[model samples]
Structure formats: structure tokens, C-alpha cells
Target chain A: MDPLEVEFLAEKETVKIIPNFSLDKIYLIGGDLGPFNPGLPVDVPVWLALNLKQRQKCRIVPPEWMEVEKLEEIPFSMGLTKLLLTHASDNIPKADEIRTLVKDIWDTRIAKLRLSADSFIREQEAHAKLDNLTLMEINTIRTFLLDSLNCMYKLRSNLQQGSSKGQFSNY
Target chain B: MSDALSDCGSDASHDGGQEDVMTPAELIEKLEEAWLNEKFSPELLSNRSEVVECVMEQLTHMEANLQRVKKGDAKASIHRMEIDRIRFVLSSYLRSRLQKIERFFPHVLEKEKSRGEGEPSLLSPEEFAFAKEYHANTETYLKAVALKRMPPNLQTVELLKAVPEPCLDSFVFLRVKEPQENILVEPETDDQREYVVDLEEGSQHLMRYRTISPLVSSGAVQLI
Candidate 1:
């Protein structure tokens, strides 16, 4: 998947936003969103929140995890942090600190991922645990990693005689 | 849009196995799952016409309602935005399928032809038609450009052998939705031995697509 598409998925995650105007409960296909009252916080998807912010109709309340200290426990995605920082940094407090902290977290996570990937390649493991790795992190190394795995598999398969062709399970 | 949609899809389902109603939200979830699975899987998955039809119905219904509302209503705009998001997903999902069909048309057609009398199809009706057309055009183009230049004995080309089949040994990242036991993990090389690992519910894993292809169609696991 493209990194942008991953960002698109992040936009669906709900965040608290304070609308500047009042509105009735809007029953949407996915779910209801509004009943927005002036100066009162309501939960909304980031896409809608960003749209409202662009119109100067609302103030985005960054998710709890966007804070510098709270970055460690974020349930949301790194792509989301970037999206919020890029689009609605004004609403988020200590934006620069959060940005730096987010970078730190991402760097640490990627570093750990590289370590694991190196070991995985060295050991020639069949499968690896995907615990706590964000989708984007996995995506970053997916192509290179899978290609290497396949190349190794092909080399091994050639060593064996009459290994059957891979079969796709029928639906 | 992110998850199960519980409020819509009261229409008759052609899938026939489950009489139980799938809510609109759940239908949406199903579509997204199918989308991602199709996107990541090396092979074309079975057609999900039920989800496609239901989602189309829901979109049509919501759109019909929007037509009655005034243009400037805040609710209408929000509804439009939601619809656009869903529409994007739906189209992306379909386009991915089309791309796969184009890539593996001969094998896909062969699979369809070789299936049993009552088995589920790999392609939807429209997709099947498109594949047939694509196959004819490709053959015509090949014959015109190169095949016709060959000796009569060598002119005949087998597309099934020519086109590379999807490699099921390719790895994928998946999340287990339903817990499963004794799922076999095949060895990658001669030195490593095959082993079975119990798939715990909600746990993610990186593994070969072939090992969990059945689990995917059964909705027991979702391809990330």
C-alpha cells in the first residue's frame, strides 16, 4: 500500500473536536457524528475534523497520545500524528515538542524493526511475530523483506527435486 | 467507514448459505476485509457480490435520501463526505480486482472453467465478461503483432503456461479474527522444519499466504 493510503485509513480514526457552531445529530452511513454545540467538544473522524478546521468552523483537539509525555502509549498511528501536525497544529498544544517526540518514537520503532529484520534474515525464519508493529512500519520493510524471503525460498526449492508448484486455495 | 455497519442492507442476499441478516456496518466491514485481502493476496479471491450489491444498495438509498434534502444542509454535506469515502474504498477494491484479473486472466478463466457444478465463482458476472473481452483483445493483439509471424505449428500459444500464476508462497501480514489451532507453518528452507502454531484470536502474524488462504475466505483472519 502507498503511504498516502495508510494515511487515509488513519483519517477514519475518531478524535475530539470543538465545533464553533451548533448542529443537530447527523446520522451518517457509518454512524452519527454531530449535535455539535459551540465551544463544546465532540468526537469526530479526523477527516471531518480537518475539513471543519479548514472551514474555520471547529478546533481540533489532538488525541491524548499526541502529548510529548503521552507519546509512548498512543493507540493511534504515526501517520495520524503527522497528518494532525501538518493540518491542525494550531489546535494541538506544544506542537513542536510533540513533533520532536513523535520523531523520536518513530525512529526508535524503526530502529527496533531494523534490528528484528536483520535477525530474521540471519536466522532464515519461516514466520515472525507481528506484535505491536504499526501498519506503516510493516509496510516500510514489506517489499524488500518479502522479496528476499522469496529469493531464498527459490534457492532452497531449487536444491530439492520435484518440489510441487505452489497452489492457491480455491474459494 | 472504519468498521462494522449495523444499520442497513435488508435486501435479499444471493450468497444463499447464510439467511441471517448482515447489517450495513458489518457489510461495510466485510467489503473492507475483502478489499484488503484482494489487495494483498497474490491470487484473486472469490467474488464478494453480496457485499458489493448490499453496499451499492446502501449508497443508492443514502443518495436517494440526500436528493430530497436541500443542497446547503450541513448534514447533507457530511453525508456526502461519508459517501465519498465509502465510494473511494469500494472503487479501489474493485479496481484492484480488475488489475488482478488483467494480470492473470488465463489462469482465472481456467479456474472458473475447472470448478465443480455448484462451486462459488472467482469472478463476478461483470468481471467475467470483462475478462473474456480482455482475453480476446490480448489474443488478437498477440496474433497480429507476433504470433502470426511464427510458423503455423509454432503459432499456437498457451496463455495458461505463458502467464505466470500468482505465487501462493508469497508472504503476507494478517490478523487472526477467529482463534484457530494447529495451523501449520511450513519450513522456508531444508534446515528449518515445519511446525504448527495455534492462531490466537486478534493476534497478528507474518506468514506465507498459502498457509492461511482458507482462513482468509472463511473470515477467520484478515489480511493487513
Candidate 2:
């Protein structure tokens, strides 16, 4: 999957936003969004929140996990951080600190991922428990890892057979 | 949109009406599941025409309602944005299926041909037509371009051998939705030992697609 597409899915994660203008409840296909009353907070998806924030119509209340001190304990999504920091940084307190902390966390997690993947390959393990790994992390290694695995399968299957033709299709 | 759901939603589920009474949110979720499954699976999966038609009906109804209201309304804008997002997913899901069909048309048609009479079809009627047309066009193109010049014995092409099948042995990341016991995990090579593992609900794993393909079809697990 494209990283942008992962970001698109991340945009669906709901966040709290305070709308400056009052409006009646709006029915949406996914679900109902807002009966926006001035100075009152309501839950809205990140996509709409960013749109409203960009238009100066709302202030986004950052999710609790985005804070610097609490960052280590909570599992953070890389796509969500990019979306929030790029568009709604002014509304979020300590945006720079959050960015640095999230990056550090990302680096540590990725280092662990690499080490595990190395062992997974070196050991020739056929199955792995992938709990707690986010879609973004899986996606980063997806193509290369899948291709190599497929190649290994093909190579192993070929050991018993004579010749295989036109196995890998053209991109 | 909610009011008009039962008015037309049931009509779309003519495949025995299994998903007859889904809410708009549930319908979107089903579509997303279908989308992700189609996106991750190595081969073409069973078509979710029921979900597709319902979403299409819902989008049309919502857009028709939008047309009646004046522009520049905040609610209207929000509704438009929501519609656009759903539409993006809907189109991307459909486009991925089409891409797979193009990549594996002959095998797709072969599967359709062999399907039992009362069983649910692998391809939707429109997709079936597309695969047939694609198969015929490719044969004609091959003959016209290169096959015609070859020796008569070598002219006939076996499409199954010509194109690669979807590699089911490829690894996939999935989250188990239902608990399964003693599912066999095949060895990578002859030297490695095979083992069985329990798939606990809500736990994620990486394994060969072939072992879990049935689970995927049954919606027992979701490919991430």
C-alpha cells in the first residue's frame, strides 16, 4: 500500500475539536458528525478536524498520547503525527517537543523491528506473531520482504522440479 | 440517507439478503473490509457486489439530496467531504479488483467456468463479461503480433502457462477475528519443521497466505 493511502486511513481516526460556530447536527454516511455549538468540544474525524482547523473554524484538542511525557507509554501512529503536526501545530501545545519525542520513539521501535526481522529471516521461520505492529511499520518492509519470501518459496519449490518458466510477472 | 436505507438497501442484497439491514456506518465498514481483503489477497476474492451496490445506492441518494440544498452551508460541506472520502475508498477498492482481473484474467475465467450451479459466483456479471472480453482480446493480440509468424505447431498459446498464477505462498500480515486451533503452519523448506499454532482472537501474525486463505474467505481474520 502507498504511504499516502495509510495516511488516508489514519485521517479517519476521530479527534476532539471545538467549533467556533454553532450548527445543527449533520448526518454523514460513515456516521453523524456534529451539532456544533460554539465553545463546546465534539468528536470529529481527523480529516474534518484538519479542514475545520485550516479554515479557522475550529481548534483541535490534541489526543492525550500526543503529549511529550506520556508519549513513551502509549503506542503512537506515525501517520497521525505527520497529519497533526503539519496542519494543526498551532492548536497543539509543544508541537516541536512532540515531534522530537515521537521521532525518537519511532527510531527505537524501528530498530527493534529490524532486529526481529533479521532473526525472522536468518532463522528461516515460517510464521511470526506480529502483535502491536502498526500498519505503517508493516508497510515500510512489505514489498521487499514479500518479494524475497516469494523468491525463497520459488527457489525451494524449484529444487524438486526441473525448470520453471515465466514465474515472476512483469511489473 | 438513513430513512432511504431500508427503502433500497434490501433490494441490493438479492444474494439472499444476508446484509439486509446494515446502517450507513456498517455499510462503509463492510466496504472497507472488502477493500482491504481485496487489496491484500494474492488472488481475486469473492466479489462484494451486495455491499458495492448498497454503497452506490447510498451515495447516489445522498448526492441527490445535496443537490436540493443551497451551496455554502457548513453541514452541506461536511457531508460533501464525508461523501468524497467514502467515494475514494469505494473507487480504490473497485480499481484494485479490476487490476487483479487484468493480471489474471484467464485463471479468473477458468474459475468462473468451473463454479457449481447453485454456488455464489466468483465474478460479478459485469466483471465476468470483462474477463471474457479481456481473454479474447489478449488471444487475438498475441496471434496478430507474434504467434502468426511462428510455426503452426507452436502458434497455439496456453494462457495458464503463459501467465503466472497469484503466489499464494507469499507472506501476509493479518489480525485474527476468531479463535482457531491447531492450524498447521507449513515449513519454509524441506529441512524446516512444520508446526501447528492457535490463532487467538485479536492477535496479529505473519504467515503464508495459503494456510489462511480459507480463514480470509470466511472472514475469520482480516489482512492488514
Tell how far residue B154 is off in model 1, in angstroms: 0.5
Supply the DockQ value of model 2: 0.63
Off by over 4 Å in 2: A163-171, B7-20
Query: Which digits, one per residue and each the tens of the lDDT, describe model 1 over residues A1-171?
Result: 888888888888888998889998877767777799999999999899999999999999887767777786764587788989999999889999888888887888889888888888788776877868888888898777778777776666767855646433221
- Please tell me which predicted candidate would have the highest DockQ against the true structure: 2
What is model 2's interface RMSD? Answer: 2.4
CA lDDT of each prediction against the hidden true structure: 0.83, 0.86
Q: What would the per-residue lDDT of candidate 1 be over residues B1-224, giving only the tens digit for each residue? A: 32333333334244443635665666777788889899899899999887887789789889998899997998888889989989999999999999989888999999999999888889999999999999999999999999999999999988888877888888889998889999999886677789999888888899889899998888798988
TM-score of chain A of 1: 0.89
